[model samples]
Target: MLVDVRNFHITGKEFERRLDEVQITVNKNSVPNDTEKPFVTSGIRVGTPSATSRGFKEPEMAKIARWMGEAARDFDGSAAQVKAEVNALCEAFPIYQ
Candidate 1:
């Protein structure tokens, strides 16, 4: 929820010029047994510019987001799985050395 879009533009209005920027998604989730706390306990950012550059469509974004949610839910079990998944993806579609 806390992000700085300064790199996208010079001013607020300028940044608003690109609607997609506001639509980015991240991967994280939580539930307090459906408790009284904020139900919006998770967050995701899929629309970042880097995602587009890496050829991630919305579907891919959603898939990764889901994996992240699962990982967040089961920090120990899912974390290792997500890490392996990411490593595989990176090896297949390397963007950096």
Candidate 2:
């Protein structure tokens, strides 16, 4: 999913920072803008290959997507809850046992 941060009133870098705070890894990407520049980084690319490899199914992936959206929409207001959920998910499916 491509999360555009323009509507969120923040830069892609800022969005990535918020995701990182919640242990969600994503990459900021350049997107078309109405400015003179051909492209401006106002979005982040979210992928679930790693999670899939870690045994995350559709339901888990959906939850992760929801968390990403929630964090993007209200990081300050939802950080603790999102972080706790992320930690719980990670604990349930640890990368290394």
Candidate 3:
């Protein structure tokens, strides 16, 4: 996205080359302002005792978020796309019932 890398976590020029791979979209972040970014995540852990949400296990909530972080690191300029992939994975988790 910003800098260059050759391989996954290599050093120097060679490491920058790996990023030459084509990019695709997955997701994107919008800071309509700035405050929104700070409080984007501050809600239920077990996900409330009553609500319309489903397939949500508090234990896995953070895990799902981490997935997006990992994906973001994999693709820079394409972070949005990688994030979308992570979101897709979360949806597949049989919790939204």
Candidate 4:
């Protein structure tokens, strides 16, 4: 829930590449959950720039967002399912071809 929506401007690869910078910001503001008290995160940061640039549509973006949110919440199998779906969509769209 604390995910920096602005991070949406950052692609996932870029996010991982610059995790330290991003983490600094997240750590500065993220607080521990009172009950769970797990390592507080700013939540999943997903961007659609590459997908959209490759011709993926809004509906696909919605599915990706849902998968991301579900994965963030630790819903079992969400990540794998999303990966498969993404592969299928990419194949269908054929970005390079």
| Candidates' C-alpha lDDT | 0.43, 0.82, 0.36, 0.45
Per-residue alpha-carbon lDDT of candidate 4 for residues 47-69, written as tens digits (9 for 90 to 100) = 45667677877787676556554
- Model 4 global lDDT (CA atoms, 0 to 1): 0.45
lDDT of 3 by residue, 1-97 (tens): 1222222343322222222232212222222232223223111122233212445565555554454334335655655664565456556654545
C-alpha lDDT of residue 10 in model 2: 74
Superior candidate under TM-score, 2 versus 3: 2
> Sorted on TM-score, highest at the top, how do the candidates line up?
2, 4, 1, 3
Which tens-of-lDDT digit does each residue in 31-75 have in candidate 2?
666221223478888887889778999899989989988997888
RMSD of 1: 13.2
When superposed on Cα atoms, how far off is each prediction in RMSD? 13.2, 2.5, 12.5, 9.3
**True-structure lDDT of candidate 3:** 0.36
The better-scoring model by TM-score among 1 and 4 is: 4
Worst 10 residues of 1 by lDDT: 15-24
Error of 4 at 17 (Å): 11
Candidate with better TM-score, 3 vs 4: 4
Higher-ranked by lDDT: 2 or 4: 2
